[model samples]
Target: MNANQTQINSLSAQSNPTPIVGIIGGGVAGATTALHLSEQGYNVVLVEKNDSLVSGPPICHLHAGGNLYREISDEQCIELLKDSIESVKLYPHTINRRPTVIATPNHDQHDPQSLFPRLLQVQQHYKQLIDLDPSNKVLGEPDDYFKVFTKQQLLALKEQQQPAHPTTIEQWLIPFAQQVDLDTLRYPVVTVQEYGWSVFRLSAQAELSLSLESKCQLQLSSKVTNIEFNPHQAKPWAVSIHSQGQTQQLQVDYLINACGFRSGSLDNLANIKRTRLVEFKAAYVANWDDNQLLWPEVIFHGQRGTPQGMAQLTPYGKHVYQLHGMTEDITLFKNGLVISDNDSQPKLPTPLLNKIDIGWSEEVVAQRTQSAISHIAQYIPSFNSASLGGKPLYGAQQIPGDDVSLRATSVWFGEQNYACIETVKASSCLPAAIKIAQQLKLTGLEPSHRSSAAEESSNKALTESDIEQYAVRLARRRGYPEALALYYGQ
Candidate 1:
C-alpha cells in the first residue's frame, strides 16, 4: 500500500471493538449521525464537499406539528412535533423561540378552521412527549400550543403599540396585526408554537461539537470519487475520497448515505437502485429596515404551484427577513422537481445544477427577489419597500418516493450494513440516528462505554453567546449577512 493508504489503514486500526462508519454528505443528517455514532464509540469519518455542515438547504422553520403544510396527514404532523422537540433538545441554540402566524386569504378555498383537528392532535402528542420527559417542553405549555384570534381581536390589537419585546403569544401578534391587511385575510387567524430555526447556528454547533469529538474525523472540502464493496473483506467498503488535490482511500465496515439531495449519486456508485425525487427550491433574503417591530413568522396559505401560492415571511434579527413564494416565478422553478429513472440518481437540469454547484446570476437574483417582495406585498402592502438583503438561500432536497407531499421520513436501510437516511426536514435527523443505532445493535455491535463522551462534551457547554459568535463567522464566511445568525428579539 502507498503511504496515504497506510496512514488511513493505521487510523482505522485504532477503532478496535467498534465499527468505522463512513458517512457521506455533511448536511444535517450526516453531521447528526457522525456525532451520535462517535458518541457511541464508533469511529466516524464525515465527508462534505462544502466547507461547512448544514449548509445545503435553507432550514428556516422548525415545523413543529408540520403546521406549515396543509395537505400532510395528521400522523405526519404528530411525528413532526415529536421530531421537532428532539431537534430542539439536540440543538437548542438554533431555535429562535418565536411563534408563527398562520392565516388564510379571503380568496383561498381552504378555511382556517380546517387546521383545528390536526392542531389538536399535535398538541396532545406534544403533551404526551412532555409527560414522558419534562425536558421535551421546548415549544411551551401544551395547553397553549396554539391560539386563535378573531378579526375583532386583531383589529383591536392593530392600533396598539408594538411591544419592545414580546413575552406572550398575544404580544407577538400585535406586530402582525398592525401590518397585515385585515380585509384580505379570513375572519380568524391562528398562531402556533412553531419557531424559527437558523441553519447557520446549527452549522456552528455541529462543527464545534464534531471538532471536540475524538472518534469523528471531519473532512470538509472533500469529495468522494469512488466506492468498492466486497462482502468477504473484514472492512467491506473501500471509499475513495479526493481532498486538497490528493486522493485518499478509507476502509470502513459500514457505509451511510446521508447525502441529502445528492444521496442518489452514492446509491448509483454502490449499484443500489432506489426510486426517489429531488426538488430544487430557493428562499430570498430581504431587509425591511422601516419595520423595526419584531414580527412573528407570517404565512398566508394558498395552493402550491399556483398563482396564489403560499407566501412565507421569516424574520431574522436586524430587520432582515427571508421570503418564500411557492409559485413558479418565485421559489418553485419550472422543471425543478425530477424523478429518478432506471438509474438511482435523478438528473437535475444543467441550469438548475449551475445554480446549485456554482451560483445564481445577479440579474436572476434581483428579478426573483423582487418578485418575492411583491408576492408578500399582496398581504402586507408595506412589504413592497423591502430590498434585497443578500443572495438567496437555495438548494435541492431529496424525497424517498414519488410523493412530493411526503413531509416526514427517517432512515431507510438498503443491503446489509448499508443505511441511507431519507430525511426531508432537519428535525428528522435525530430519529434517523436513533434507528441507525438500533440497527447497529442488532448487528451484534455493542456500544462502548464511551457513550458518556457525548454527555461529557455537552458538559463542556457551548453558551448561546459562543454559538452566536461562531454562527456570525460562519454566516459571513458563507456570504450571508451576520444578522441571519442572530435570533430575532434576542
Candidate 2:
C-alpha cells in the first residue's frame, strides 16, 4: 500500500471505547454538534450524503435580529442577534459587520427623528409580551438604544451645544437630513446594529475544520439507510450506512439528526413521532457594476394592499448583490404529518418547483432567474442595467412552525436515545450544539484536549470581514469564486 493510505489505515485501526455520537447531515448544525461533542472528549462520526460538507447551492446573509422575526420580545430578539454574532466569531474568518438599512418609498416628508416614536411604541409592545411570559428571562443586557429611546431626548441632542450623551438615533442620523433624497427612496436610512454577512464557503470550512479535530471521524458521501435501536446495551443505536454500493454497521451511544430539510425522514427511521412541513421559496443573486449604488442591506416595503411581500437587497461588496423577493410560499405539506409519497405533495406555484427541485436544473433555473430579475426590477429600477452574473442559483428549506417548536434545536425521543434538530437559521447552530452537548452530559476534556481552548483564545483578534476576505482568497486560489458569489463575488 502507498504511504498515505498506510497512515490512514493506521489511524483508523486505533479504536477508542469512549462514547460515540452519530450525527447525520453535515450542514452547519451537524458540523457544530460534532465539533462540540468532540471537544467534550466524545467520539463523533458525522455522515453526509453530499461530497462537500455544505451541499446544495449557496445561501447567504445571515440575518441578525434587525428585521427578520416578529411576535418575540426585544430581549429575545436581541439575544438571537447576539448569538448570531458570537457563533460567527467562533470561526477564524467568515462574517462582515456591514451596516443594514431599511428604505421606504418617498412620501410626505418627515424628519428622521419622527420614526423614533413608532419604534418606541414597538418596544413597549414587546415589553408587554415579555411581562406575559413567565418562563422567558432576559439573559443578557440588550442594546440600551434599542430598548429605550425617546424623541424628546433625541431632539434635545440635535438642539444642544453638543449634548453630553447622545442617543443612538441622533448619532446615526447626524447626516440623515442632509442625505435625504425625496425624489428616490433613500430618505430615512435607519442604521441598524452591525449586521454581519456570513461567507458560505468559509463558514463551511470553519465548521468542518473545527469538527475534524483529534476525536471526530468524518464520513462524506455516505447515506444512512436504516437505524436499529439497541436499548439493551450502553450503545443504543446500530446505524446501517450505505456507501459506494457497500453496507456497514456502526454502533453509537447517541444519534443526533442534524439533517436540515430531510430531518423528518431521519426521524421517521428512528421511529420518532413527529411531523415535517417543507416549502419551496424562490431566490436569486443580481450583480451590478455600480459601486456607488452599494448601500447598507436594503429592505423595500410596499404600500397597503400591494402585491409585493417585503423584498430584500444585501450587498456582497465588489459591485455584486443578492435579491430575494419571495413569491407565494409553495407549501410542501397539506395539513399535518407527511406520511408517504402520496401525503408529501408539493404545492408548486410555478412549474419550476418541480423541474428545479433541491438541486439545480438548466430550464427551471433559467425561468426562476428571469422571474427574480423581473420581480426586483419593479422596485429597484437600477437592476434593469446590471448584467447577469452566471446561471441563477435555486434551492429550498423545510418550513419551521409551532408544531415543531420545542424540537427546533434538539429533542430526545425517549425510546431510541435519538435526538433531532430542525434548525431554520444557521446562527442557532452553535448554541444548539452546546445545549445538546450539555443535554447528553458528555464527559469533560483531558489535559491534552485543553490546548484547543487555548488555540481559540489566541486567534481572537480576527475581524468580521477577515473570513470573507479569506473566502475570496481561497476562491481566487481555486481560479474563481463560484461558490462564494452570493457573499464575496469575484
Clashes per candidate (backbone, < 3 Å): 0, 3
Model 1, 26-121: lDDT tens digits are 999999999888887887889899888889989999999998899998889888999999998888898998889999999899889988888888
What count of clashes does model 1 give? 0
Per lDDT, the best of the predicted structures is: 1
Q: Estimate each model's TM-score.
A: 0.97, 0.71
**Candidate 2's residue-wise lDDT over 336-451, tens digit each?**
22222422222344444443443456564455555556655665565666555444434445544434222223333344557776555666677777777776763332212336
Off by more than 4 A, model 1: 1-7, 451-454, 458-460
Q: Where does the lowest 10-residue lDDT sum fall in candidate 1?
A: 1-10
Task: Determine which window of 10 residues in candidate 2 has minimal summed lDDT.
Answer: 330-339
Write down the TM-score for model 1: 0.97
Q: Once superposed on the true structure, which residue ranges of model 2 sit more than 4 Å away at CA?
A: 1-17, 56-58, 70-76, 105-187, 291-293, 302-306, 329-363, 400-415, 442-490
